[model samples]
Target chain A: MNTELKLQALLDGALDAREIREIEAILAQDIQSAALMQELKWMKAAVAGNEAEVKLPETREFYWSKIERGIAAEAKQAAAAPAERAWWLRFIYPATGLAAMVAVMFVVSGGRTTDGADTESVPEDVNAISFRSEAEAMSVVYVADENGTFNPVGQETKNEPEADK
Target chain B: MPQPPDFTTTLDVQLVAFSQAGDMIAFEELVARHRDKIYARAFSMMRNEEDAIDLSQEAWVKAWQRLKQFQGDSSFATWMTRIVINLCLDQLRRQKRTRAESIEQLDEELGGVERQMPVVASNPTEGLERAELRKRIDKAMTQLSYEHRTVLILHEFEEMEYKQIAKVMNCSIGTVMSRLFYARRRLASLLQSLKKEQQS
Candidate 1:
């Protein structure tokens, strides 16, 4: 250790026997270090003997009242936090379950024939023909009008008047 | 629940257990029991009464929050003390951020000009009564920089070892030793000056 650290260790009684002997020999040879040792010893003794014991200036009740206020406030916040979370969860839990149920119903009931019949054969006089396009992944519904022409529900036929005109 | 023994006479461990179980009364008792020591520790580090009081109370609030985490490794007071010390350190750090840097602070970091002075030969406290000595020490403590005062308080007043102080201060053992060495030397110098002032 360096000289200052060695001296500190010596004062702290932290030195092993060999280090203690070394420091002692140095102290005997060095007047400055010896004086430092004397000063440090006196200082340590005085401080250890007379460390101040200060009490809080406020009355005990007054001081504790502040802490009690703090605790109460924190406890209230703590209690309120869980309640607020539970309120949100009350709404969120059913919403999430509803979404899951809708997804499951969609998965179970999607794209199935309701009756036990082949879907390819159209009824002889049926006016609406629904076409499923496998490549584009879309279903198109076409209705046959009085002229026996099929028209997609949303698209205008040739005889329709343009609204903007 | 066996009517929960009077909190005033309850031991710290019992009080802590009750506190963990959400008993505010037990925590209030703990606060009353150790408030002075905790406040004194904060005051020793912060050297400001308001800051000490705030920090000590904050430490108690923290203890209440973390009561369940108290695994009985150390005494509740010691654990509480560590919390207060941490708060004081954080308070000091915040204050330090706004503090102006000065040549004097630099000098203190480098052990100051006092490190070169001839060592005082006589015991400065030799002729004083115990009460007077304590008063003088308290006055001298106020004059020290936070780092020096903190190391002295930890070593002398708190009776902490260098390693423990190092851990608390979050510095190396060598830094603790150097700080303690400088603190003692500075305390000795201050006491000598105080003695002279008294004589004059």
Candidate 2:
């Protein structure tokens, strides 16, 4: 191969020592060869240039901790998963049951009716009344308490009428 | 006196065996052993130290997760290096997907701006010390595109075969050869130009 092709291959280590030496001799025979050789040598060095020292980054403990924890988790998973993991599931069920019970009690006990339904807080059995919607299709007829009154929306009675008196 | 065993060699076999058997500590030791080399390889490819470090760590996590597949066909370090290279390539491919590079348009290699480099008739490294030479070369290397820079690092520093570089780069061996060729040429021109500037 010509010097141009040989130069690249030589730097590539594709050309053996004998080929390199022969090229060196040929170049020694010509001045222009010397310029070409210089370019080739510099090119080789610049590419094959000694590498900068590679510094290993200092490791963070947090990174190691992640690996440690992940492995520990796997270890725990292997050793006794049903015991530890089941606790979380088991706790969820009972806690959910307690919350559901509280919700049910809140609905059934009718604790402290705040919507002015309490003005007539007379326990339903004592002075039972059913109020009907004006549509009557939804009868909410507050069966009139024998006391003769029920305020469904909780408006106050200002005064008794003469007829009632 | 009995010769001491090569600790790294011994440790590598032991760790690989332990890790294959599902020992997490053994895998961690392997990570610590090879992290720097893998990190450097990724950094060289990506040219972004932070991303390189992250990807290298991700590669380790993956390697540990997939330790079962390692058949021990190669040296552990070589196997690990392969993993890191694959991760870096995946990251590059992801970036390539988001980039606007048209393969058809980019195939044409321009002679490029370095071709017009001013004359540098003198030897740049003639009298400079090795440290200075390395510094200048590193600066020149930084000027190369990621594609070109990766080929040069793999070829020169890693001493990887062209076929191996092609695999790492996900390109044909011909592409590897061409990139190395052009990269070396541009670097030669750049360095000599830098040298000329230093001298004058």
Candidate 3:
């Protein structure tokens, strides 16, 4: 580095005493060198003065409040996202849809024989059974007893059956 | 364990840690400590109060967002200052696109008085009152082109080394030296004339 730069570095605490001496020897060489050193000294002072006198602007509490709000807003935006995503809806909606599907399937395939024996095996999720008599198709329907027997449904002829018996 | 750090030291570390954890209050403390320097840098670059303030504020937000990457390799203020400088440079680049007038064009015409600076004047700022010195420096500083004033501010006021300044200004070391030399020459001449005006 140039001697003047070395001197500047020395003044700024970026150089050691050995470097300072080397620069000091260079400065002792000529009158021009001495004049330049003096100028440097004064310039350093002027720079220090300028730095000290630089007035920091007035940032009000309100300004800080705005920054705080902006940060908070960013944080809120980043945090609130996954919560509003309806993550449970991602699970529950599909689940409820599956349940509705099972129910419709049960209604579609839950037909039993007249003596209440299941004529067709159904899926594993089938829980309870009900039947509807159709005029165009099977005229009657039955409820299945666990003994693999069927009893005709809508057959409660309380009066006519007793009289016949 | 080492002795407990004092309040400010403890606070600085805590602020960094908290801000890294996305704490606003801690980030605000960091901002409050360095906003003046940040604003001063932006203002020196943009040369407008409102734009400087806005850009500086945006820089702080960015710093908060990017706090995780800070490895504490340097002082926290240094890291933060770099953030603000980048923001200012990005702003300058954007403005260049819309205005269609590069800094070179401006320097060729209007900012010449800075490029062709006079020699150092005699004791320009030595004996001046503090307020007068500030005003004179402000005026002279405004006279410098964006390039020169930016180098001067980073070097003189911020006490940045040539290499650090190159990184901040995104320029080469040779350019940094040239700009610093011309800027100081102009500043010396300006200070001298301001002093003369006062004497008269």
Candidate 4:
């Protein structure tokens, strides 16, 4: 290790017995090293002694009241999240069910009935089911026909089907 | 209701028990007891009054939340101090990430300009009165980089060992030692310069 690091380790009492003896030998013979060690000791003492013990600028009531408000707010937030999640679930659960129902409808209608009649073939007939998302400034349009046929359109052509409908 | 017991006179352990038992007043008493110390620790690390107040309050809220986990292995004040320190450390890390590094931070890899200064034999704080010494120390502390000031506060003021500081700082013990060494050296240099300015 570097000499400075060794000296610092010696001061911090981080050295093992062997390293201590070696540093001790150096300190005993080297007057300069000994003085440097003393300086370091003085520096440590001055810092440790004179560290400022600061007080809160606010009053006791003021400080504790802020903390009190924080705790109450955190508790309120913690309690609110689950309720909010449940509220979201109220919408999400039914939305998910609706999506599942729509998927099932698509699957059931994909085949011909035993009576040789077409099922409610909305998948093939409902071409370009365009959805405009209220949250985002964008619209999504999917091209599908009544026969469960699909045709993807480019961005420029995407508006034509919606306008056509 | 019957008169509540004098919580101000109640010991920390009993107060912790009361708080954990869902007594808000008891938790308020605990906050009153150690708010300054916790605030001081945050101020020492963050060196900003606004951040210190905000983070200290947040720590108290966290302490209240985690009061059930307080097994009393340490004093309530000590436990609370740890929370504030961790909050300050986290805030500092966030601030560090957002802002560009300061000149001192850039020089930290090479131990900074203070490392090249000669050691002054005279004690920088020897002749100053106690208040003045404290004032100078606090001012000088602001001159250090965040890492340097943190290590110094942890090792010198908090009296943590290199190993403990390393764990808290998430670095090896060698880094802690080196930082502590540089911090002290830089502080000594700053103090001497302050003393010289006072003389002239």
The best candidate in terms of TM-score: 4
Weakest 10 consecutive residues, lDDT, candidate 2 chain B?
B111-120
Worst lDDT run of 10 residues, candidate 1 chain B, spans B109-118
Chain A accuracy as TM-score for every candidate? 0.48, 0.28, 0.40, 0.49
Residue A81's C-alpha lDDT in candidate 4?
Answer: 93
The 10 consecutive residues of candidate 1 chain A with the worst lDDT sum are A113-122
Best-to-worst ranking by TM-score: 4, 1, 2, 3
- Lowest lDDT 10-residue stretch of candidate 4 chain A: A116-125
**Candidates 1 onward: DockQ, in order:** 0.51, 0.17, 0.12, 0.45
Clash counts for all predictions: 0, 11, 3, 6
Regions more than 4 Å wrong, model 4: A85-165, B1-4, B110-115
TM-score of 1: 0.74
Docking class of 3: incorrect
For DockQ, the strongest prediction is 1
Q: Against the unseen true structure, what C-alpha lDDT does each candidate score?
A: 0.83, 0.69, 0.68, 0.83
Instruction: After superposing candidate 2 on the true structure, give the runs of residues whose Cα lies further than 4 Å from its correct spot.
Output: A1-6, A15-38, A46-49, A66-165, B1-10, B100-122
Give a tens-digit lDDT track for model 4, residues B1-200.
89966798888898889889999888888888888899999999999999999999999999999998999898888889889989999999899899988776877846645447677788888888889888998999998888989999988888889999999888888888778878888888889899899899
What does the lDDT read for residue A44 in candidate 2?
A: 63
What TM-score would you give candidate 3 relative to the actual structure? 0.59
The docking quality of candidate 4, as DockQ, is: 0.45
Q: Please report how far candidate 2 places residue A109 from its true position, in Å.
A: 71
- Candidate 1 stretches with Cα past 4 Å from truth are A79-165, B1-5, B112-114
Per-model TM-score on C-alpha atoms: 0.74, 0.59, 0.59, 0.76
Which candidate order results from sorting by lDDT in descending order?
A: 1, 4, 2, 3
